[model samples]
Each structure stands twice: as C-alpha cells, then as structure tokens.
Target: METFAEVLIILVVLTNLKLLGSSRATACIRTVAAQGVLLAALPLVTSGDAITLRMIAQALVSGTLKAFVLPFLLLRATRGARAGRELAPFVGYTTSILLGVALMPLALALGRKLGVTGPAGADLLAPAALFTLLVGLLIIVCRKQAVTLVVGYLAMENGIYAMGLAFAQREPLLVEMGILLDVFAAVFVMGLVARHIHREFDTLDTDRLSSLKG
Candidate 1:
C-alpha cells in the first residue's frame, strides 16, 4: 500500500510537470483531468479500513467533478476562444524544466525538515505534495493564459488533496465535500470569465485583461 501511494504521488508529480511544460491548451486540460483522477485514487491507496462511507462518496464526487466535468467545461471554453497558439510562458520550457528539477531537492529537504508524519510518513506524501504545490505556483506565475492559470489552480488543489489524504482518517467527509464544492464553483466562474474574455477581447490572454490599470 505504501508503494502504491508512492507510485500515485510520482504519477501526480509527473503530470504536474507535463502540465507546466505543455503548450497546448487541450493537452494541459487533459493532463489536469488525469491529475484529478490520480487525486481521487489517492485516498484509496492510503485508506486503512477506517475510512467511512461518506468519505468514499466524497472522494467519488471529487474525482468525477474534477476529472471529468471541470476539464470538459474548460475544453469547451478553450474551443470558443480564438487563441490556438501554445501558451506564452514567462519562462522558456527548458528553463522551467530546469527550475522544476532544482526545486525537487528543495522540496525533499523541506519535507524532511517539516517532519510530517502520516501513516506513510513524509517519505511518500510530503515531498510530492510540496513539489506539486511549487509547480502550481510556477505555472500561475508564468502562464499568461486564463485556462493555463486554471490548470495551475487545479494543480495546487491536487497538492492539497494529496496532503489531505495523508490525514484522511482525521479529515471530516464534510470538509472534503466542501472543498470539492468550492473547486466546482471556482471552475464554473472561471469558465464563464473565460467565455467573456474570449467574447470581449477576441483573445484569451490574461495579460490583456489588465488594461484597466491606472
């Protein structure tokens, strides 16, 4: 079971790297959806039969909504947008990958220092969660597309979810349900805003939305 959790954490981290490096909007959305599925499966991997039915149901809802519905909506919005070019990243691909590589050891060190003791200890969960969180932050900072930012947001949520799974027994099912609900609401609002941005600016570049500056 520990091995399974580690594998899922690796998969999640790899998917985050893909999301960071990929230029195509469709490809990024698909990758984010894949991350969501991995997050949904994470609970199962770490479960110790102490998990309740309500928690299981919450996980299912989170998986379906995050993995399928949210990404589907984002893809549809992407199609509506006129911009088809790869995302204009503030940092080049090679630089971003290098930064991600550099950040890995930092994340591991941070995890070790934090000494987060879960059912599996910090060995599997903490470093991966920290790395994913950093990748999400990098994406949010560098990507100029709203869709890409949303993907980054989802990546951050994935990291949080991974961390939450570490304490799945202590976490209330209602809290998980609320988190999913918040994510759903956020995605819905972002989709609407994406559509509006496409309609108004004739493009989806997030930089352009800042024209109201004084």
Candidate 2:
C-alpha cells in the first residue's frame, strides 16, 4: 500500500510538470484528466485493508467528473470559443517549466518541515499536493486565456481535494458530495463566461477584456 501511494504521488507530481510544460490546450486538459484518474485511486491505497463502500462511491463520482465530465465541458467550451494554444502568457512557457521544476525542491522541503503525512499509506501526498497547488497558481498567474485559467482553477481544486485525503477517514460523504457539486458549478459557470467572451471579443485572451468600455 505504501508503495502504491508513493507511485501514485510520483505520477501526480509528473502531471504537474506536464501541465506547466504543455502548450496545447487539449493536451493540458487531457493531462489534468489523467491526474484526476490517479487521484481517484488514491483513497483505495490509503484506506489500508478496510476499504468502505463510501470510499468507492467517492472515487467513482470524483473520477467521472474529473476525468470525463469536466474535460468534456472544457472541450465543448474550447470548441465554442475557438480557443487554441496558450499564446502570449505573461510568463513564457520555457520560464514556466523552469519555475515548475524549481518549485519541486521548495515543496519537498516545506512538506518535510511541516511534518505532515497522509494516514498510513499516503506519506508522500503532502509534497505532491503542495506541488500541484503551486503549479496551478503559476498557471493562473502566467497564462492569458480564460480557458487556461479555468484549467488552473481545476488543478488548484484538485490540490485541495488531495489535501483532504490526509484525513479521508474522518470526512463525511456529504462533504465530498458538496465539494463535487461546487466544482461542477464553478466549471459550468466559467465555461459559459469564456464562450461569451469569445463571442464578443473574437479571442479568448483575457487581456483583451481591458478594451471593454463598460
């Protein structure tokens, strides 16, 4: 179980780097979906030998949304908006990747300093969660398009979900349902706004919004 958790955490870390380095919006969306699938498996490994029905429900619901529903929403939004690559970010792609690489050591050190570990099998979740949060923040600040920002928001949301896994045994199923509902609402709203923005502005670049008079 410990080894499973470690491998899962490492894969999550790799997805973070992939998100930072990827330019094609479709590729980024797929990578985030992959991360969702990995995280959905997280509870099973961390549950040790006494896995519950509730955990299975949570993983199934979470995986369906993260891997399929959310990505499909984003893809539909992208098609509606005619969105493409993340061009003209405030920070360049190369720099973003370099920064992502640099953040790993810092996250690992901070994770250790905090001395927090996930229950039993999930010792490496802390650093991986932190890395994901930082990468999401980086994408949020550096990228210019509304679609990319939505992607970043999802990544940050995933990070928070991962942190919650440290206390998975104690969290109620109701709270998990609430989190999923909130996430779905947020993405739905963001997708609508992005499509509208493109309809009016002819581009998804959020920097174009400053030209609006009202």
What is the lDDT of every predicted structure here?
Answer: 0.79, 0.86
Query: Model 2, poorest ten-residue lDDT window?
Result: 164-173
lDDT (0-100) at residue 71 of candidate 2?
Answer: 95
RMSD (Cα, Å) for all candidates, in order, is 1.8, 1.7
| Tens-digit per-residue lDDT, 146-166, candidate 1 | 888888898888887776665
Query: In candidate 1, residue 107 scores what lDDT?
Result: 88
Candidate 2 Cα deviation (angstroms), residue 99: 0.4
- Cα misplacement distance, residue 200 of candidate 1 (Å): 1.0
Model 1 residue 130 distance off true place after TM-score fit, in angstroms: 1.1
How well does candidate 1 match the true structure in TM-score terms?
0.92
Best by lDDT: 2
> Candidate 2 — which pairs collide?
none
